[model samples]
Target: KTTDILVQAQICAALNRHVIDVTTPNVGLQDWSNSAEYYQQSPCNHYAKFWDQQGISVDQLAYGFPYDDVFEYSSSVHTPSPSRVVVSFGPYTDGGGNDNDEDITGMGGNLSVQFTDSPAGEGFANLIDNDAATKYLTFNSSAWVQFQANNAYSLSSYSITSANDAPQRDPLNWNLQGSNDGVNWTALDVRSGVDFPSRQQKQTFQVAANSAFTYFRFNLTNNSGSILQLAEIELFGEGSSSGFSQTIQAENYSSMSGVQLENGAGAEADQNVGYIDTNDWMAFNSINIPNSGNYTVSYRVASEGSGGELSLDVNGGANVLGYRTVPGTGGWYNWTTVSHTIYIEAGTYNFGIFAQTGGWNLDSWTISLASGASAQSAATAFNSENSMLEIAEISLSPNPAKSQLQIDFTAEHANLTLLNAHGRLMESTSNVPSGSLLSISHLKKGLYFLQVEIDGKVTVKHFIKE
Candidate 1:
């Protein structure tokens, strides 16, 4: 399949796993493999609640993730007559509360935009309507838009999009300011002589926000023309609880010195950072280590040769965290997860991943509070497959298993049976501990079910042999 197709499949799978819909806010999952009859139950649980939001469509099908079209969950509406398509604009409001459509600030949609130093009737609501065609136009050369979140956020980065037309009206100089109180503002990021070559072009800038702030303002100092117009502004940051786990794709760096994205060969991993050289680094801004003590950082990497090492640091090496030596995984496309625990101070940082030695590809990385990380057990990791047979006690890892399938449960003595797609018994075992690795190297690549029975209670889990 093409990258687009694979990405769509991944998005559909992610949405299904999370059970995200209009009513529920993704509480927990009951199954992982099946979502055909998922909506039959009310208040379903979902995954990735931090970023994913319910769609605006009547059916609640939206593209919360990048690849959400695989199972037709995309908000993109198709029609036979493209020329006849018409989009309706909203009934504008004057700087009132806004339901965070994307949860971009991680503030649970409880945010409002306040306009300052701008003439009346500038249509401030259009600034964040997710529509580039509509704009917040003002005759004034300088303007400021303040975003107020319910909780203080350690903002890492922000983006500004140019209006649909009039290049001369684009902003040239701007300052991103943060503040606890709206009166006292401190500049976090400043840019001058900025250019927007294309219309509706979005440029993201990293903010050196060390502390969390309740209010953030975009101070547009100067513009190319007397009439300044802007399409939209977005803020990215972390909220009060930094204990939650955040997984970031290696290719999705805010900035990079020497790195490139290539097609990933691993299961569900479509892209990865490759062609890394020694001293080459990638920067991910606004990584919030809220009152951090011990945090576990895991990286999914692959290398064909040894001597490759990855070092992690914060804020241009102002604080060097640690380094991990990469072991050869036989092939450049082969992948494995490696982790390390490191202590960090309470602050927001620009996390820098440097290549101490070359010859490895990085797919992704995850950071979680070590103190709260253990709460996520295997069962919690892989939520649901069949709700009717859903057993919260048992869980499986690497669902699209290549070789060994890990079964995690606390059952003292459980009988395990593996059956192929046709329900014919293939493998059987007895008396396995909580963390047991079952070898299925001989099994063919296809759909299979693992039936686990403990104390006369039977539970079936669905997995794919990749």
Candidate 2:
């Protein structure tokens, strides 16, 4: 028969007999009597015969045994069923020990119990007794709890209260630590000397894996040992992290109505205008003007003493306009409006008010576009080139002329183009006689650009037709 058939037959024989003699003396005992005798001698002997038949030695059988009971009997002595298993129940004195009887009673699974003396002395026994209502652990002093590394965890909220009626402890403390391994830890934050009775505070900590930390802990550095307190701790920021940009506008002040002012004296003091001391000037943070136009500026100023004079610098176009001084009004709060009209060219300009006088009060300043008839008169007299160009002094005899408009140029020869408001050429003339008068009597009344090209340079003079 094949080895497989022979093994199968042996297995069937053992099963039918309901016992396998693996340790029968290798005297080649094939008889049932010899196998039973070997098994009776010892379980290991039976196991040896049974395995030897399969070409396994006693040691191999011992090593390869699947059942623990079989392996134990093969290597050690066998004990009969005992009446009871020894168990130690607690320090029944304070009712603070584990119940060992539960093991033999089979009421619950394997029970091994011990009693540890209460760290707290005296009547504190009730506090440590493992009863349903009173079982709790208390740390009368500062303590630290360590958590496993590389894992995210949270803390439970805790409270601290003063034990004494009076303030025995002035401050309490707590801190948090994170660690990659159990041994090395990094302190995240610490709070010290906290007044527990007055304020209840809570804190949280988030430890990142990138910080090479895997553990976290809370250390109660100090606390008032009066009442039981706890804190709830939570962990976040496991996978995401978060961060700001600011835009600042350039400082400028150009508008007529939006001028800002700063004064060190009383509210009724006049403002010192013109010069801007970097330390005392009120400046605008930005200049966003819609369009540029001629702006008129005026300010009120006064000095502290009779001889006290405040000088201010008016700046524009890469240069100072002029410095003006305000004479004193002879009293502490005395003030006056010393005003001037400044013709500001069309463009954004930064300006500020500063005082040179030691002790003076300045206040109520008004600046705006020249009003009404003065504006019209000023616009009329302002020359385009004011004698700089060789063009004949342009004169409109009767400026509010009803009919013919006259123009004169001093050049021997010139090119001229009378353009309408939109700069469209309405009339053009070349080789104009020197000091000769040109007339445009046919045009209707409105604004026009009298562009005169003299010696290849263009000078545009704005005028109105009557």
Q: lDDT (CA) for every model shown?
A: 0.64, 0.37
| Model 2 misplacement above 4 A | 1-293, 307-317, 354-359, 372-466
How far residue 113's Cα lies from its native spot in candidate 2, in Å, is 99
lDDT (Cα, tens digit) per residue for candidate 2, span 1-466? 6877655655554443335656777624554422222222222433333442211222212322333223123433346986766645421111111221010010001111112222443122222111112221233445453333212222222222233222332225767666544467777656777664532122223232334233555565444553222322223322111101111121223332322444436665333333222224333323222111122334455555652333223442233332334566765445665543233333344544444343444443444433221223223223433545544454434443446555566666665555443332344454555555556454443455665666555566766543
Name the candidate that leads on TM-score. Answer: 1
- TM-scores of all predicted structures: 0.33, 0.21
Q: Any idea what lDDT model 2 has? A: 0.37
lDDT of 1 by residue, 316-374 (tens): 97767766768789888888898765656556889999998989989999987664322
* Cα distance off (Å), candidate 2, residue 125: 99
lDDT of 1 at 136: 83
How accurate locally is residue 191 in candidate 2, as Cα lDDT from 0 to 100?
Answer: 72
Candidate 2 lDDT score at position 333: 48
Lowest lDDT 10-mer window, candidate 1? 92-101
